[model samples]
Target chain A: MSGYIEAGYISVFSVLTLYGGSLIIRVRKTEKKLPDLTEEKKD
Target chain B: MSEVNFAAIPQVFSKRAETATKIIGVLALLSLIATVWLGLFVTPPDQFMGNLVRLLYVHPPIAWVMFVAYGVAFLSTLLYLWPRTRDLRFDRLAGASSEVGVIFTGLTLLSGSIWGRPTWGTWWTWDPLLTTTALLFVMYLGYLALRRLPGDPETRAKRSAIGGLVAFIDVPIVYFSVLWWKSLHQAPTVLDPVTGKTYIHGSMAYTLLLGFVAFTLLYVYFVAKRYRLERLKYLYDRVLLDEAIQERKREAADFKAYGADKKSLVPTAFAENGPALGDARFFGTEEESVVGGGEAGR
Candidate 1:
């Protein structure tokens, strides 16, 4: 394939990565609350 | 729901949540890096398809994730709403699944449009496959809107459960819409019509697999995180409600005690003074004994 096609492929994957990474970061921030629920359940 | 029985939210998620999140993170990294190298440096351009074939990397995975999200919603709804096996946990699961479904469906349409514009020469088409998939997305959105309607949890659960189940029928129709109608959308391209081999080979196949795994992990993480948040909100609401009810009960008890004390004091005053005979005359009674008459009857 030509360099342009190769670049296009990278762009596609880059978009996927960006979208997926953003979601992961959001989840990490919220995960801190998860343990509070477990402790409450035990009590 | 009472305080004791209401589910608790966790400060840290369970193993599934942790694992799924990690996998999603790693896969996202790998997909980004690898696709950049592979698409930009490895894969060659097609003489006819040009750069358009690169879209295959994104479109297929987006469609798969969207379908998988709907599957999660359908399965959870069945487990949650079935009378004999009805489990409220599934309610959270269904909500989480639907949320992911909505996200991925939007992605599917976006990627599909990107692929269509260059190849089909239009951003939108009336093709049967595209039309049905669009319809499927809209129905689940309605399911979500209905879920947010005002009422108690139980009522919301029932309505959304029915909506989830009814919406499941659209999945199959969407899958087969191309077969059922003549359309401009390309027929299934994965199959080799002559050799029966998949069109994808080598690194392309591996990267596609990586994308699939990454999306699946991400979906799981989001759903679990959302479920935990929902459980916490539920517990918080129950605690507040319980406190309110207890406060009301205490107030009622105090009022009863105060009323009883007032009643006892009234008789004490009447009994102590014995209300002189003229007090009866105050009421125009003929005899002073009438004061005791009423108290004695009591």
Candidate 2:
């Protein structure tokens, strides 16, 4: 019973955190290049 | 295509927009963590299902969020396609939401499987709920794939928009499958048409409701972040395209100039192979005799 409970909690945590982490990673990567991209627009 | 300079317009989310995104993300995470803590330790185990019931907090919320994401994608696609409000920004939104929606959908399946393994004695079954969900997942996955096809931006948007619209039909079917058919899955615990109230109450119901709210905020953050990324990739690709077109134009110009010179622009042939250069000039004597004799007789 505790195993089932733990699995459920672990799954929830892992999924939500992973999804959030993915968003943060994407935002950082894209943000890093944003200046160059906008500079292109100006040029 | 005619060559044009592609300036990558960076979709800078304004400072205000960035701030809002951060706040939403923080709030969502905080609420979700609170809900998990309450569910795991604070809430009592079910008399019948026992602690396995904890999945109710996470599973239903995830499923609801996935639906919300798909709904956003569908509406955005519709806006893009409608003549009154057609725009590539909406297309960007549609594609972005669809990608996040796919991720959520996949997680829904994964979570469902984990919960199912304990309750159903197997990780998966071809149940109506499960089957329709799997179908929905694949359809949106197809929508994401459609976004990657090579073409002019407008054409690609139109194609992907149409795909996003068509793939959305499965959403309703997935939602209703449990009701319309004999499903092994449980009926809705939150909706009660007969009693007109939720089947749950107390801290249990409270946590579930908060889960929905928290995950909705999470969904907003996910879509916002993903949208920024989509715009970034779009701009980068256009920048590369501009470089390619420019190179091609330059090569074409050089080739055109070379061809024009080949036709005797300032005839190097005379300078290189003439009587002055000590090479026998073709028809030189004939030219001299004809011209000289005519001038002498005159």
- Candidate-wise lDDT, in order: 0.68, 0.79
Candidate 2 lDDT, B83-141, residue by residue in tens? 99998889988887787788778878888888888888998999999999999999988
Worst 10 residues of 2 chain B by lDDT: B289-298
Task: Give the TM-score between model 1's chain B and the true chain B.
Answer: 0.77
Candidate topping lDDT: 2
At residue B291, what lDDT does model 1 achieve?
A: 42
Angstrom error at residue B239, model 1: 2.1
- Listed per prediction, chain B TM-scores read 0.77, 0.81
lDDT, residue B215, candidate 2:
81
What is model 2's DockQ versus the real complex?
Answer: 0.40
